[model samples]
Target: MTATTQPLHGRVDPAALPRHVSLADTVGQTMTMAWRATLKMRRNFEQFFDVTIQPLLFTAMFAGIFGGAISGSVDNYLPLLIPGLIGQTVLTACVATGTQLREDMDKGVFDRFKVLPISRIAPLAGPMVADMIRYFIAATLTFATGIAMGYRPGGGVVGVAAAILLAIVAGWSLAWIFTWFGTVGSSAQAVQGISLMVMFPLTFLSNAFVPTDTMPGWLQAFADINPVSHIISAIRDLANDGAVTAEVGWALLGCLAVIAIFAPLSVRGFTKKM
Candidate 1:
């Protein structure tokens, strides 16, 4: 018997692969991934419905329905309604981030990412960063809808801008929690359903729609403690008075706490999946 020898085809050595990347390189890679996500959103234009159509529709619907009943006039209610709707819209917009992430994972997209030489956080953070555009859209449209409905803000342009900025920051911070859910969820639908379960109580049970005083004593107690209440109140303070109050500081502190907790959990969960 004759022994045959095979020639080595050019294959990379596994041991030679990079184990760590510089911060600059990681940031560059993250930006590249973010660009990819932006392109995806462009192609899937309908994905903007939550940020665009929902804001316009919900703002009109709520203002029309609750305007007279809540504050005696739509004009009078706009200040309260606008801020609350902005918070709700931004929070709802964030739900899509997790659903899409779950879908990508289900479709084995993350499997492809496993072979790439990039920071694992890039693929996760990129889509989140890109989703900020959606948050901004939701915030802007909510304000525009309020304006078109004769809801003038007292805070002027600077206060309105600050309010939008706060919503975006809070939305981005909350998205991390949902992103962690996406990493572990069984399906896209499951992630969305779970997110809604958590969001409905936060959005509705608080002072978003009605005054906490109007609610029952026990429910008012819960609403007072809810973090969503703090966010909506903070936004209202900025949009109505253009003042940064204790509520705004509390909202920001809550955001920082959320990031400090969920960011690490999300990274750990995601790495395990990889």
Candidate 2:
């Protein structure tokens, strides 16, 4: 055959290579996919009901129940409970993201994506990025509700801002864990069921609802070491004490640790079909 119709001798043209193979290209592709999903969320704005409603109901209920039980008055409990609510709400929103991923798989969206020239990581990264909006809404409403209930942080506006930032980062990082589940789980319901089983124990048993010191010996031991406790403590310290203390440092360190361990695993799971 003539060179015009012949395949290249031994070397393939670099320009012909798929962009997804490179790290920068993959990240850009992922971000673009994520951006598309974000725009979709904006267009279907009514879907934000959970983000808006859950925080409102939770802040009201938990503030009344746990707040009254622990701190005795809304006046005194708002500061402590609001930060805890922020952590709990953000963590809970993460589950929906994984469940959505399972839905996408069921509808063959992921199968279509896998056949495209786009980076394999794009599907997973896109959902993770899109899910941040949910976290942001939850955190914002939780903080706002706290303020309305007479909660003010000693760390001033900056502390309030940091608390929100922490919620976003923590929520984003934890999404990796659920992404792994979505990659492996058989169905959306299974993903939700598994995630809830784990999250309920983690969030409820920690300092989110009560102090660690009030627990039984074995339970207190678990609560002390729980990452959720650290996050809640950091938020409380920043909001109530106005100091960037060791708890914040440790909490951030824990979040980074989670990201480091799970991000690569998530990428691998996304790239290879189950």
Candidate 3:
């Protein structure tokens, strides 16, 4: 009888592997993943429809349909409609994040990602960071459409910039909730349906397309309490009055709260799937 010993050929040294990824490493990996997501967006140009065509089309349709009815003229409605459209567009753009995330997960993209030696949060956060570009595009086009339609913002350039920044931030914050949904949802279609269900009420029920005072008492109360309403009001104050009011503070606070709550939840849910 003979005993045989196995050779250690091509064996990996356990100590050679990174014990803990550093902060800088995590950030770098996140940025790398973000670049990948951006490249995907560029390749699939249709992914940009929500940020571009939708904003322009909706702005025109709403202005044409409701402008004269609400504010006596399209020009008069620009100030209110533009800000509301910015919020709506940004929120709409955010829906794609969850839908795409679910699609990727279903396609086994995240399964491949699970084997990579990078920060777990990077996969979830990267696409979200890349989505900021869509938010910016939607916000910019909304403002440009308003300007083209003779909607002069009294808040000037600085005010408009602030409003755009607010819209992007708010959109990014709200996206975390959808990302969490994507992490838990069974399919891309399911996530899209859930996102739309949440978006319609928040957007339409808010003071987005019309004045809250004109609404019934109960609806007005809901609109006043809606976070979307606060964000839109903040945008209006910044773009129409050139002022940072308490609404701006509330909007930012709400964004922080959403990120605080949903970001962790998304990460946890994603980890469970992994």
Please report the candidate that would top lDDT against the real structure: 3
* lDDT for residue 60 in candidate 2, whole number 0-100: 86
Clash tally for model 3: 0
lDDT of each: 0.89, 0.80, 0.91
TM-score, cand. 1 = 0.92
Model 2: how far residue 244 lies from native, Å: 1.6
Using all chains and alpha carbons, the TM-scores for the candidates as numbered come to: 0.92, 0.89, 0.92
Write the residue-wise lDDT of candidate 1 on 62-181 in tens digits: 989999999998999899999999889888887889899989988888776666677878888889889989999999999999999998888899999999999999999999989988
Q: Model 3, 87-149: lDDT tens per residue? A: 888888888899999899888888766656778789999888999999999999999988988
Clashes of each: 0, 0, 0
Q: Compared with the true structure, what per-residue lDDT tens digits does model 2 show for residues 178-256?
A: 8888877889999999989978888988988777888999999998898988988888887777678898899999999
- Clashing residue pairs found in predicted model 1: none
- Which stretches in model 3 have alpha-carbon errors above 4 Å? 1-20
